[model samples]
Target: MPLALYLLALAVFAMGTSEFMLAGLLPDLAADLGVTVGAAGTLTSAFAVGMAVGAPLMAALARAWPRRATLLGFTLTFAAAHAVGAVTASFPVLFATRIVAALANAGFLAVALTAAAALVPADRKGRALAVLLSGTTLATVAGVPGGSVLGTLLGWRAAFWAVAVLCLPAALGILTGVPADRGRRETSGGPALRVEFAQLTGVPLLRAMLLGALVNAATFAGFTFLAPVVTGPAGLGEWWVPVALVLFGAGSFAGVTVAGRLADRRPGSVLAVGGPLLLLGWPALALLAERPAVLLALVFVQGALSFALGATLITRVLYEAAAAPTLAGAYATAALNTGAATGPLIAAAALTTAAGVLGPLWTSGLLVAAALLTALPARAATTPGRNPEAAR
Candidate 1:
């Protein structure tokens, strides 16, 4: 991997921190904004919706621009959005900033994946994407826990300021680290938006994307409510929330690391094992969440399995859409965010019911099972000329 790829990972780390810090800050945010915790959670959905809507549109509009410039522009915009978020007192204003930040976040991720994929051989796109996404996993390990501590010690706004400070260096990294032509590809005569949409909407790609969405939804459903789950049934206090988050993040990092090595070699096999394991892990989490001794252990397992499946999903999508890898990568980003947006809503609704804290476990489990079914046909789709027929 080139230095530029790692720099792209750094950019992802900053964005990922911004994206996930809200999870740990939800209680503080709800209290500060005078909103219900469920309502406060909508801020997360807002960000995901923005990413789902903005990534492809931004990618299309900026397709003609140089990759390095596009990445730099988005990173600066993201940093500015965080600054706006840090100062906002009104809930609506804060919500708006999340949308703005997510837009930039989506664009940066889509372009970063394209750049990373372009830098490597076709055979290594899986590893390339995994390495790029490792930054996201690392953010969970470092950024989320760090943000939790910052939020606990200072305030929720301080976490935003911290993310803002982190972004400046990420922006500088992209501007100075990535070469002008580093993995740059000509986009002058690329497929138009409608054409790209038609290509991406193919059955194979759609199934792969749906699988991505479902699996991501499952991960977020559990993760979105994790703070409360730990404090309530898991028998941990507020101080231990960061510790739980750290354990989850550590597992995610390890999962992605191992998946990266295996994804390029046998993506189908990775998915075969990873997806089902995620399904199994959730029930285990649901069962163990009330037992403090075992709950943390299950959280780590679920976290690792969720991310491992994610790496395989990305690899499968890229393989299925080799004809238009850039757009495919962008669409994949959109798909994942679509799930990220929906998962919290589902988990929030579950919280309202008698299922309480454990509801997300069941919700996530069903989604993971659905994801597995959707993913099953993807291997056949990877074969040239078989995608359309195999999906049937």
Candidate 2:
């Protein structure tokens, strides 16, 4: 890979770490902030909501700016949000900071996808995106675990501080390493945004992208509560929880790589495989939660399948939205953020009335099934055409 790509990946690593650290720190945060664990989970939901709202809004506003400038500005915003979050004593303030951080994160990722596509040749887009997205997966494997450990030992505030600290270098890296690109062609007048929105809506492929997002959200609903599920009913210690997360993260890394390769070879087939695997894995995840050894194995499978689905869906969206790739990418980000926001809320609701951890997992599985059904229309509507370049 090129050095620029590596730097972008590093920036992504920082961003991803900042975004996901909340999940691991939820228990510690709840205790420190004097809120219920359920409330602490809302921090993640808040960030997701911010991301959902920010991606398109930022994209629309920044439509005429150079891609490099947009990316750098978003990174700066991400850094600032983390810094504020680190120092805030008030819970509401912290929540607001999370929203700011999430918005920046959402914008950063949307721009980054567009930048990554521009960085590489058309044929190599999938691989390039995979490399960029690997940063998020790496955060899951290393950053989240480290953040959790740091928060446990030093207080959850320290974790946020660490994320804030990393932002400085990330900003510097972006300034130094990211290449400048010409501004995107903006649509003329007030009708432009409406036209773009209408174009996206009219596309069957975009609907598939949204469905993909829903599936991803449904899976996360269960996964977000993973620490509790493992540490509580599953009878694992806190120390063991991070280990399970590491296993899941490792699986995600493999899944993403495989998905990229498969997407290059056969996009539709990869999507088909991912949907069934996800549907099958959730029930298995529920069953395996009772057995430590089995649960460990299942966690790996769940992470792999879930992330595989995500990567495949992204590649499909890129392909199908070829006419308006940048806008399509923004739409994809929107779907994902929407899912991120929905997952935790849904899981939290299920946890209230349903039997143990099984409730959330079962509910998530059913939702994923519905998402899978949405893909059928997508597949029928947008058949994968030859793209030999994608294989490259």
lDDT of candidate 2 over 91-129, digit per residue (tens) = 999999989988888877877777777677777777887
Candidate 1: count of backbone clashes, pairs at least 3 residues apart or interchain: 0
Against the true structure, candidate 2 has what lDDT? Answer: 0.77
TM-score of each: 0.95, 0.93
Clash tally, candidates in order: 0, 1
lDDT of 1 by residue, 227-335 (tens): 9988998888988888888888888888888888877666666677777788888888888788986988887888898888777777667666666755766887888
- Choose the strongest candidate by lDDT: 1
Kindly report which residue stretches of model 1 are placed more than 4 angstroms away from their true locations once superposed: 183-185, 376-392
